[model samples]
Target: MADAPQEIEALIDMMARLPGLGPRSARRAVLHLIARRGQLLAPLAQAMQAVAETARECLNCGNIATADICPICASEARANGELCVVEDVADLWAMERAGVFRGRYHVLGGTLSALDSIGPEELRIPRLLDRIEAENITEVILALNATVDGQTTAHYIADALEGRVRVSSLAQGVPVGGELDYLDDGTITAALRARKTL
Candidate 1:
């Protein structure tokens, strides 16, 4: 509006909606992108467009993938009879970045919450139960956050999967109310190593 081009303004607005980015940072980022249009902006635009069209939830796991089944779900090497359940895709990516767990992943999309009206039906809980038997999963590791909602969700899943598979959770190393994405690789590794049965 203030003498800025409509396209640039729109880009800034969209960037501002990204997590952890504010209007001020979005404006600066847009300006930097425009300055490096040929090298950065154009390619980034293309990549975003491509992902927007192709990105979808994996059928087996709830992880985002370009295909129906994510690479991790499709890989035989990852079918280690252990499944780590995370509350979000970012948490799954964080676990992958740590490179400590060799098993598959099950993304719950979100935690159950009565205040927000979210429930098991909304968070892929039923699908997870079906997957346990279908995939012959031996162990389920709850890598949910330390928040109240996160712990509640973990307990729900542990109860649901009891007797079907050995269920465990990330140990005390994870800070209270902390999300996995905020934890360092070493902490993730240590927590995973010290995981206790739920």
Candidate 2:
């Protein structure tokens, strides 16, 4: 097969760098887009440009927003005195997609990493504390990821707000469809510890 032009090859290279897309997939996608340039490629380019210009982080939380504050932060109904702490905007989006939690969110952007030299100051920890008091937060639900750095950050936050407000963490355990045999030792232990009596 003949090689794509330099510009098309560059687009393919950039698309391949996107998550879940390899070179073959990106090349196929580029071909598909080029085949329907007016329908898909032009609109996709416009959308990307729009997002690049308007997308920004919320001033209060780290969640993505086109405005200064996210809709969740602006909505009074979400001010239920409960704050859900998360590691990243993606995690906050995941919780919203589940529709299980009805509260405000605080995105930490990242967790503590001694190796990477990340600390509480690097994240939105200070802002989190400010919101806890300013928003009259009654409880802080630690919804951080199940990673070593995540847990360390959770512990640090828990200690910081120990006497000020109620602190709790999401229960870690096996997934609904997970099998005991498929679970790792750490997951199995966490599942057993988090088990509730019927």
Candidate 3:
């Protein structure tokens, strides 16, 4: 790196810090970007700058957006009286990817954790309660992860919304078409506990 151009080396160093990228890959990527500077690198830099300037979290749901409210919240059709609460925006995006859920979403940013000192205030819980009444929500689905923290958060939310709206969770299972033998013990147990009649 000593003999390399300072700007190129700096770029490689920064790229290497990105997830799943290492020094070798970063160096290769830098070289490729430099080779295609006119076609790719310049546009990529401009796009990054634009996003950095405009990207912000949605005021209502905590989802990343260019504006205060995201497109989902602004849409009329999405206000279907069902709100799916998730631990992160990533989970919200995953739900959208599946394309089954037609209702709106609420991103908690993260689950409540005593160790990290994260409480309801830190997680947009109050905003969620406000939305429940303001949006005429009839059901609140807890789509949080299966982790202990996720479950605790779900239970807390259920208690908070008790007598206000119907609360439910994603059914426990081996995933669609997944074999029981491939699942972990806890998953098997949850599936058994949540069994339904055919």
Candidate 4:
């Protein structure tokens, strides 16, 4: 890397910082991209630029979008009185990919973590509470990860909305400590179908 051109080395360093990519993998990816600049690299660069400029978090659900509200939030058909609460936008996308949920979603941004000083205020808990009555929500499904923090956050939310609405959680299909983004579509569907009251 020290011998490589400064610009190329900088690109490799940035790529290396990406999740699942190390220095070696980034170096290989850079070389591959350079070799196919026209077919892959150029298009990838353009797409990245476009998203960087246009991507915004949906104000209603915290989902990634180009406008104030995401398509799902804007759609009247999605208002089924059920709201699936996920820890992050990735989890919401995973649920959408499964195509088992017909209602709306609420992204909490992250779970509660005492070590990290993350509390209900750090997440979208206040907004979620407001949405329950604003949307006439009947059920709130906790689709958070199976980690300790995730369960803690779920319990906190359940307690907060104890009498306001019904609260439930995904069933046994999810493995302990497993994240929603890594689950298979079938497993996600089964979990949703077998969700239990919190």
Which candidate leads the pack in TM-score?
A: 2
Which sequence of candidate numbers ranks them by TM-score, best first?
2, 3, 4, 1
TM-score of 2: 0.94
The runs of at least 3 residues in candidate 4 whose Cα sits more than 4 Å from the true structure, single-residue gaps closed, are 173-198
Lowest lDDT sum, 10 consecutive residues, model 4, at: 169-178
Instruction: Give the Å shift of residue 36 in candidate 4.
Output: 0.7
Off by over 4 Å in 1: 174-198
TM-scores, one per candidate = 0.85, 0.94, 0.93, 0.87
Overall local distance difference test of candidate 2: 0.95
State the displacement of the C-alpha of residue 112, model 2, in Å, after optimal TM-score superposition: 0.5
**Which of 1 and 2 is the better model by lDDT?**
2
Candidate 2 per-residue lDDT over residues 41-158, each given as its tens digit = 9999999999999999999998999999999999999999999999998999899999999999999999999999999899999999999889999999999989899899999999
lDDT of 4 at 48: 100
Per-residue CA lDDT of model 1 for 1-198, tens digit only, reads: 677998889889999999999999999999999999999999998999999999999998999999999999999999889999999999999999999999999999999999999999999899999988888899999999988999999989988887889999987678779899988887788789888899
The alpha-carbon deviation from the true structure for residue 50 of candidate 2, after best TM-score superposition, in angstroms, is: 1.1
Q: Considering only N, C-alpha and C atoms within 3 Å, which residue pairs clash in candidate 4?
A: none
In order, the Cα lDDT scores of the candidates are 0.92, 0.95, 0.94, 0.95
Runs in model 2 with CA error above 4 Å?
none
